[model samples]
Target: GRPLRVHSTEDGPLRAYRVYHSSWLRAAVVAVTFSHLLLALIEPRAGDGESYYTSFGSRANEPPDAVRAGLGRDVLWAELVMLLLYAADNMLKVYAVGWGNFFSVAAYSASSMFKTEKWDVLRIALVFAFLVEVIVALSTDVAWRPLRFLRPLFIVSYFREVRRWVAVCVKMIPKVFEMFLFILVVIGLYAVLGNLLFFKSGFYADEELQNFDTIGHSLVSVFVLLSSENYPTIMNPAFFRPDHTGSVWYGLYFFSFLLIGLFCLSNLLVPILYQAFKHHRQRLALKNHVRERRALLAAFQELDQNRNGLVTLARFTDLVVRLRPDIKKGDEDAATIAR
Candidate 1:
């Protein structure tokens, strides 16, 4: 049997790893990425000051506006700079982790790969879009800019905390699907019932198809009613006939649907999501704790110079200084805490 091999930071170039993990480098990348997104928003909009005819007219003869179609000059340059930086960032990671380890599908366990490798591929697509826009601008009247709105997705990847939240949300996908199916089933049942009870009831005008005239129409109406919007419009017709002769019993059907669908079932989603988030957070914390303990044990074993199970205070302080050189060597408190 073959042993399961695992790759870690040690497999990569140490110098590149240090530079990749440096605080200042991450801050610079984040700042540039955010500026790229900000510039995209504040750039001029299409037809802001033009006449109605020109603004809303057929675009067939109108000259292509590269800024409106693809990316404005301001955003284009920013995006170019950011993509270069991101590309460099990926290069550094590849150097640190090695090519096979960096791009391997099995390496997705490293959470950083969730954004890094995927976004690298997305960046390649974006570069192709940039080239197409440039070619179109130089050769034809048509604008084929694909980088207009997608450049901002990379910005979220720079925030480590946000990345974790996104991972948690991804884990909640199954639960979300379950909730969606439950809602669909409930809506289907109510739609069939509504169609049976309200078909040809004359509460809806002959011209209006939005009423429960068919199963499909009833489904759409009930779905809308589940949001509690236009409740009087839907309920008033059912409670009082078109001729103004009716009974209060019609109100019970709507009241029950609202009680179950609007108030009860819809509200179930909040707690389900909350519980999923809470569980994810706890699991993450536990995983981090276990990893920390393993790392600490490994460090302690390495620091134990002798085969015996103890480390000197001096050695521990030296280890601390080696790991965090920013700590002053003369700080006795750091050594004391190390003891």
Candidate 2:
């Protein structure tokens, strides 16, 4: 065999072959360009509401309609881009790799677009929408079997950029876990103090500590009070009892602590929980991903006969025999194999 020359130039044929031959790379370019165009067209019309769509609203009384309308527009544009990419990908596969391979490659390419920022919104949405049209078109049913093979190809799209993102997230996971544990500790402390000082045996027992029975009970009550809009009503009657000065002081202290622990602490935990949940889910996904990659690597290694890192049929048969010890050598020889 002639020596295979490597090129360093960006526009080299090898680079071009990798780019054009890769369904994912092509889909990503298309998906991102289309998403940006769609976002640019729709974002200005969203006005100040665009900011609200990306972040949780600070204002408690903000109308649902305003929020929903803003979110709906962004969602619509995202879906539009996804649909366009799906159609383009299908068409390209049909033209390049025949109808039989179209579903598989298109499914793979669509999965690959998840790594691109332009299509990331759609990708995240798809996680929640797996039972819906997008995944069904890509991965479910006999008609979509080819799509299953392409699923692994999507990982390639993430190789360069996602590694960096994963690295940052990996570094932050321990810190986030520590913060979450700290919040849990604070909640535990509050429960213990609230029970011992206020609920268990105190002067304000009848009023301030009416419903609470134990430390656990008081903690539940505190959680309820913090979450409720009727907290002010509950507090006013208990704290203002003219007969007990102790009740007044206890109420004031409880209310102050409740505000800090429930409102402030709970709100802070929201983002931490979000990040932790994301990290855990991604960890599970990464584990499964590694397993799949290992299987493919094993298959490739088996194909490399003569221990030369080059694939051939003889090595593949040896690997098959190694994998299936139950089959006799005669049966293995009789098995029809593809080149």
Count clashing residue pairs per candidate: 1, 2
Clashing pairs in 1: 12-96
Over 4 Å off, model 1: 1-15, 39-74, 104-142, 145-152, 206-209, 240-242, 245-249, 324-339
Candidate 1 lDDT, 1-339, residue by residue in tens: 111122352534656767887899988877877776786464433343443223223474586464454434444455566667776886786677667875667666654432234655555566556546545433543333445577566764556566687789899888678898998999999888888788867786642656898888888888878988776777777775657666555677788899999788889988998898888889999998886776677667878969589988788787777556568667976686687
lDDT of 2: 0.49
Q: State residue 189's C-alpha deviation in candidate 1, in Å.
A: 1.4
Please report, as a residue range, the 10-residue window in candidate 2 with the lowest summed lDDT. Answer: 1-10
lDDT leader: 1
lDDT of each: 0.67, 0.49
* Per-model TM values vs. the true structure: 0.71, 0.32
Residue 336, model 2: lDDT of 47
Candidate 2: residue 124 Cα off by (Å): 36
Off by over 4 Å in 2: 1-217, 226-234, 240-251, 281-289, 307-309, 312-339
RMSD of candidate 1 to the true fold?
A: 6.5
